[model samples]
Target: MKLKITVLFIAFISSLTIAQTKVGTIDSEYIIGMMPETKKVVEITKSYGAMLDSTFSIRVTDFKVRLEDYKLKEKDMGELEKKTIQKELAGLEQDIKKYQKNGNTLMGLKRDELMRPLYTMLSEAIAFVAKENGYTQILTITGNEFAYIDSKFDITELVLKKLGITIPKG
Candidate 1:
């Protein structure tokens, strides 16, 4: 009787362990990008790009008009006068280039600054969801990797929801 009971208990414990499913997979970038914070980050980047683009447009338009004015005066000007104007225009162009370079650097820094907070939040959310849902492991599927995962085992939607991402109804 004792042997039978011990065997039954071990079998039950093994069955319980076997009953728990282990699942993992890679999520599409498109799906991850739909997170609300990700959308906000994209919007911020677009706004910065638009500002830089408009600034460049205005500067180029002004420079073109200035260049035309200089060309019209070239016939009446001495060599020194023409050289001075050319130097000034060259300096202006250099300034514009510097501005663009600085804008790119600043935009990158700002984007990273903004993303840090969001990343921390997302990490916490993922942890919370993983713990609550008993997710033993969740793997990120990136490019050039084939993870053997069943589509039915994906918990991406649940994780997204835990991160406060709202799923749109089809």
Candidate 2:
């Protein structure tokens, strides 16, 4: 009787472990970008990029005009004033180039800053959904890196549907 009881206990524990190991993978990028909140974030990102670009353009033109005026009067200015003007102009030029180079929504540090919170929220949501559905584990595999995931294991469709993403069929 004790041996049967021990076997049952061990079986129960094994099942519990198996249950907790429920795994799922998300095309996290797809999910995040699909959500409505992402649309707002994208607009914000675009606005920020435009603002940076306009600001940089104004600063560059303003600084260039000032530098030209300083150069025209360099002979009358003290060495200290000349050096200070050159340094300021150089700094402004650098700012213009840096802002221009980075003024794209696709490549800004703000992308990650905006995305991380969404990622965290997704993670929490995933955990909640998985527990409710008795999933034990979740994994994300990109197309480039994933060579062989069985179609049955590909829960992307199910997850997207569950998340209310109605992807159109091609």
Candidate 3:
């Protein structure tokens, strides 16, 4: 009997606590998109990507030239010389493949490096908005997650306003 009474008391208190929880959703990407700083990050990232591509292109060209020269001259060479050129070409091929892979990774690292400060600014704005508005929890979400969400509970504008981002006029 006492266990049943204790369970009911706990349930009542839990309900009260649940009722006080305030959930807020923000599209942080949208806020970041509106920031003037984003343009500079995009430009710098593109330039860095272009630089990587140019270097890769040059490496590939040299590899192709070396392979073509080896193929053309192999008929006249002794077995030992042929083997040495083939091995050198194989090593160059491997280097090219490795450089292509590393180029992609380097691009990602550069983008992340450029965006880190903007993300930090956005995070601070989100924190300030959460505290000021008494939001118990703040979520950065894609709109597709919820079938329906009340606009009043979306704190994107609040965070943007705090960040001093001027919305572009359509």
Candidate 4:
């Protein structure tokens, strides 16, 4: 009976050890923002945005100029000519709207394309840090899903360090 009780106690303790879970939290966005590569992404995105803006601006300006010209000449033009001009103006307006929508979609695709590799690198770093620190689970604290997290469990800095990134002292 004594040997059986000792064996039961040992099993219970071993079970408790096996059930222990080490959880860590990381803010991947914070780590990505701190990365040096993010600056280049930001710059490239800005340049691309500027180019899109300029192209849209030129189209809008041309539309406005043509609209003003039509308005000025409408009084002197015949009925059929006026209708034709109006149709042209409507077509230009629709084209501008379509171009704006397409440009926004293209910009979104470009942003994702530019950031995919960075996100992959960040993911790998987070995994490495979690494994090295013996974390059974690593949760991302992003958006509004995570309401509260203990500071002790935060591994953002650890992940950055693992990626060879130096945090600025402030």
Candidate 5:
């Protein structure tokens, strides 16, 4: 009958639509954590941070020592000498603040510089896995981007495997 043929055609079209859209979810944070390069980046950043801390500490100690010496000698010094020491101490304080601010900025830049390549590699692996598996879209689940996702749709392990990174066995 004409009605039966129309129903069958609609069902076929519905099936085709369902088959074309293959959505998968990936946890980028989880993937990045599993990478060995991440650990190395963290260690390198920590060492750099320690070096900055040491430099800042030395400067602070020098400032403290100079201030204490100035205080002890102030009673015996002329008014001009006291004013000059005060100005010098103020300048040292400003230098310390500037160094702290610049050190934070440098650390952020270094972290981005070191992590960019790793991120690019991860992105490539994800793309490759998506393409190979015929996935139309891969969504990140790391930041609660999706309210609900079936576990079967998660391709995180597949992505890790594609990158030659072994997933840690629980």
Candidate 6:
């Protein structure tokens, strides 16, 4: 009789633990896209991209002008002088390529800088909503990696609500 009672107690505890686990999914990207403040971030990112593009364009223009000048003067230049100009032009060409690579990296960094705060805000709101709703785990849906997640378990709308956002009706 005592063994039976102990077994029942253990079974009850296990059931409680299993029942406490509540998993939910949220699409944070959708939440961020819906945010009005994202417009400002987009504008700033575009401006930064344009600045990088212009810098690249100026370097290309400078290289072309120098190449033209070198071509015009190459005939009158001495051996050593010609070699010096050639070396300088080669270095400038390499520098321009390096600038283009660096510009791409800088643009990515700037985008992260702009998006960090919005992600942070969404993270905090998600946490609050999860705790309030007794969620044991929250997953983010990206692409179609998830074979299938029941819509009833999606807490995205709840999270948006927590952040005082309303999902626009289709």
TM-score of each: 0.69, 0.66, 0.85, 0.88, 0.87, 0.91
Q: Give the Cα-based TM-score of candidate 2 against the true structure.
A: 0.66
| Candidate 5 residue spans exceeding 4 A from truth | 1-16
Candidate 1, poorest ten consecutive residues by summed lDDT: 23-32
Q: How many backbone clashes does candidate 6 have?
A: 0
RMSD of 4: 2.6
Maximum-TM-score candidate: 6
The residue ranges of model 3 lying beyond 4 angstroms of the native Cα positions read 1-19
Model 3 lDDT tens row, 104-151: 999899999999999999999999999898898987785558877788
lDDT of 1 by residue, 1-170 (tens): 99999999999999988767555653645445776778889899889889888998898888888999999999999999999999999988998899889888988998888788776766676667667777777676657476366776666787777766777889
What does candidate 6's lDDT look like per residue over 74-113, in tens digits? 9999999999999999999999999999999999999999
Model 2, 80: alpha-carbon shift in Å?
Answer: 6.1
The better candidate by lDDT, 1 or 2, is 1
* Cα RMSD (angstroms) for every candidate in the order listed: 5.3, 4.6, 3.6, 2.6, 2.3, 1.6
Query: Which residue pairs does candidate 4 place in steric collision?
Result: none
Error of 6 at 45 (Å): 0.8
Model 5 poorest 10 in a row by lDDT: 139-148
Candidate 3 clashing pairs, residues 3+ apart or interchain: none
Which structure is stronger by lDDT: 1 or 3?
3
For candidate 1, the per-residue lDDT at 165 reads 73
**Model 5 global lDDT (CA atoms, 0 to 1):** 0.94
How many angstroms is residue 64 displaced in model 5 relative to the true structure, after the best TM-score fit? 1.1
CA lDDT of each prediction against the hidden true structure: 0.78, 0.75, 0.91, 0.91, 0.94, 0.93
The alpha-carbon deviation from the true structure for residue 112 of candidate 5, after best TM-score superposition, in angstroms, is 1.0
Candidate 2 lDDT by residue in tens digits, 1-170: 99999999999999987766756666766777677778887888788777777877788789879888988999999999989988988888887777677666444678678777877877776776677667777677655476566655556666666667778778
